[model samples]
Target: MNPAGSLVESLLPLPVLLPLLGAGAALVLAGRPRVQRWVSVGVLVAVVAISAVLVAGAADRPHVLTVGSWPAPIGITLVADQLSTIMLLTSMTVTLLVLLYAIGQGTSDDETRTPVSIFHPTYLVLAAGVANAFLSGDLFNLYVGFEVLLMASYVLLTLGGTRSRVRAGLTYVVVNVVSSLIFLIGIALVYAAVGTLNLAQISERMAAVDPGTQLAIHLVLLTAFGIKAAVFPLSAWLPDSYPTAAAPVTAVFAGLLTKVGVYSIIRTQTLLFPDDPVAEDILMIAALATMVIGALGAIAQDDVKRVLSFTLVSHIGYMIFGVALATPAGVGAAIFYVVHHITVQATLFCVAGLVERVGGSTSTTRLAGLAAASPLLAVLYFVPAINLGGIPPLSGFIGKLGLVEAGVQDGSVLAWFLVGGAVLTSLLTLYAMAKVWVLAFWRPRDQLPVEHPEDAEFNDLDHEDDPDRRFPVMIGAGRAGSGEESYSGAFLGAARTASDDERVPVALPRGMTVATGTLVAVGLALTLVAGPLYSLTDRAAADLTARTPYVTAVFGQTVDERVTR
Candidate 1:
């Protein structure tokens, strides 16, 4: 068998299917946490391996897996083009790292009520949803994928159900449910108008329709995805919801979910409604508003996670700018940007969690003197932070360069203005990151004046379990202590010590430097592989913009003339 063909067969579906099966197996034998953790790790590793093979072999051919041996348009399908493969591989790697990190930083004693048991199942389900969204051949299937992931997220976001978390979850749930409803309505309209749910069929039909009807459909779908993507007017739900989740959960959501929305927008723009008269104008205005508003929110934030959340919302504008350009280079840059942002943003959020763990809090007002506490942690924090702010020599620099260059060559005055705004946004992002660094890592203790414990007369509460009072991080139970709240517990008759401490903080382990190092290495991999990655992005962009391969592969035949405007 040809390696490329075999590679395609194994690469596309196996990553998702293997995990789905593993989640079921884990649930069936849920009595054992150790077994569940190991099974989840093994499943994720398998996914990573398969993803790597796909990325390596993607140069040979793009793979399309028809799930049930039925033809694509009628049956669900998964397609692994260069861009989708890249995202799939990265998402797997980041999620696995977060899971491993979480394993070490065990849950607090309140695990049962927090939906921690559902973590493995829901995480895999979200992964399946992501793969399905990337691979989906039709509009309705994309909606289904979105629903799978969103519902899973609703559980994950409110995992612990702390007071703040419940509030955040309510907002997240309501906003997303509304978006889902809009998405369904838009899909129904598209299906009724075009008489087909396949993406290519819709595109072909859209071309035959009048500009008014076509734009109406396009804008309707965009509105739904815009909310999902957290774009300007539709983006208010993001900052409040995202910052409240646990570290690993927040990391995965930041890394992958919003990008899925951006991906859908790109696919719809480049494939279904190419070069619409209104796309550039509308997106340009929206991109400007998103960039400015998101940046301002990031700057105003005192909490580390909240700042990062706002930054994530703002950065989606760059993707929108690329898609609006309607050129292969622009879309290619968007693909590159999406991958770059995923790694950098996810890593930064994880590092922020470590900061909150090590320092007493993530609030800039409270955190200080980390340089004295741990320089290694500072390095872990600074590298990705600067990279995310789009500093040169990192992958972010390369990605932003691609987007700006594409804008310059695009020949639209508006494009030039957007390019300028991107530069300004980058600088503003740097300012925001620098504010965090100064407050959290670099400021001198004497300058800020440490709090006087003597004056406060703080007491470590001692109960019967006082001899055993311990906060655990990454399995630091026996004598090792952490300031952060934990989820340690006992079985039916076992002695259990449980209490809530709003004042104490979670501390990162000495070895967590390893987790941070792993993430930094992943970022470096993007820079190291820049040439090959860019080439792959170019090919993917060409394939997407051409739209022929996807159409023929999914629909079995090209759409008829009546379906195309």
Candidate 2:
């Protein structure tokens, strides 16, 4: 390889390495948040730069690193193909901006549920785990990556340790632990059957394995990933759990974690078990159910976070729809949708966070007149909201178009059904968003549903009310903008410092707005660059379908050579 190739490959591992280093340093500097912020944010920014480099370099060739001087199927290998590199770039961008938003939250609120230092370390660990999952070249390492991120997420989810958080966190913990156990069991089964844990090796050896063994192992792995991805029946945990955490924390989960699961599914299905009819049929059915059920669920939601959470589940079906098609166009559409959803979804949750701050609540029923109070907040919500709802000219529309077109090209009856389901789901999603917009942003605050003493908070759903805390303050409240005069007042029981005019000026920490806005811009950037981006994903899906670039990069041997050997 040339020097340029070596440099690109060398950077393949840095996204995972640097974040672990920053996490440790953050732990060391736990007492000084300022230093920790610099360390964590600086590390993530560097990762973003490196991930972008990997994307640029991987347009033609994948970059691979062999750990401990060991060869493929022996040592831990890190890989960055067009697919993984793009995922790294997208995830890192979101993680960096979200970290900045989190920093703003820490600086503004001064609420000490969990200190900034601790949040920084845990958050960095989470980022590292996300990178590891994307870059891993083997199954064992992939499982390890999930565990690492799950551990970090457990802490992040229950950060405040509030009753709602703790209760929901417990459910989340049990579900993931069970999924992880199933995953481990599946790994053991895979190794026993295939004689190797490396993904590249498994891909080479899978065809020779018994059909029954393949089916069993495949089902087990899909079940595990499905639980993590929150696909329909496996999805009951997300809507309840995510709404309880702080805004930034929930946004991270909403944006990154399930997508990690989706990424795993993409890798496993395409590389190891491409074009399996049983798998495709199951995935197609699952996709249809997930789209309809998740959308209906979202329409029933009254809380901001829960609505977004259900929407998150609904969109996972879109990604699965791409996978079910099992064509290059299908996979490319899935990848594009994944990127679009991550940025757009995180922006909505951040806006939801801002809503919690500006309106003093996340409930559409309890909040009102946000269009009058903070037009900026409304606009912030509007762009991503429409994007998520598949309004035209946005990346979301492009992605959905790609998926529907792929389904049409597939020409299978099941595929056609899913294509229609997807369109219906899109319409339902828009309706849900419009419902929130009408109630939360358009209605006058005085006309909000009057809260009786017996009326439970939106998050309560059915959980018994804890006497100790009925409605604790949302975190991260500082004076709104740096230049704006801070008026001491309240908006619908929300802690507010704003001018007393009919339209209260909503002031958010500038960093938070800037971070969220940057992501919104990135989401838009995808639209502007859609042609190039789709071309890149087109090549990536071709590579995954070919299955040679990834295998040769990992094993240092051609597929023919491996087969002959």
Clash pairs detected, candidate 2: 109-476, 109-477, 360-494, 480-507
TM-score of each: 0.88, 0.93
Question: What is candidate 1's lDDT per residue for 350-392, written digit by digit as tens?
Answer: 8876775665346676566676567777888888888888888
Worst 10 residues of 1 by lDDT: 456-465
Clashes of 2: 4
What is candidate 2's lDDT per residue for 1-565, written digit by digit as tens? 5888899987888898899999999889876656767898799989999998999999888888988879888999899899999999998899888888877663333435566656777888999999999999989999999999999999988876677788999999999999999999999999999899999989988999998889999999999999999997899999989888888888888889999999999999999998589989999999999999999999998888899999999999999999988999999999999999999999999998888766656877667888877787888999899999999999999999999999999999999999999999999999999999998888876664444444434334312344423233333323232344232334443322223324354576576788888888888899999999999998999999889999988877887886799
In model 2, state the lDDT of residue 416: 96
What's the residue-level lDDT of 335 in candidate 1?
A: 93
What are the lDDT scores of the predictions, listed in order?
Answer: 0.75, 0.85
Q: Score residue 203 of candidate 2 by CA lDDT.
A: 92
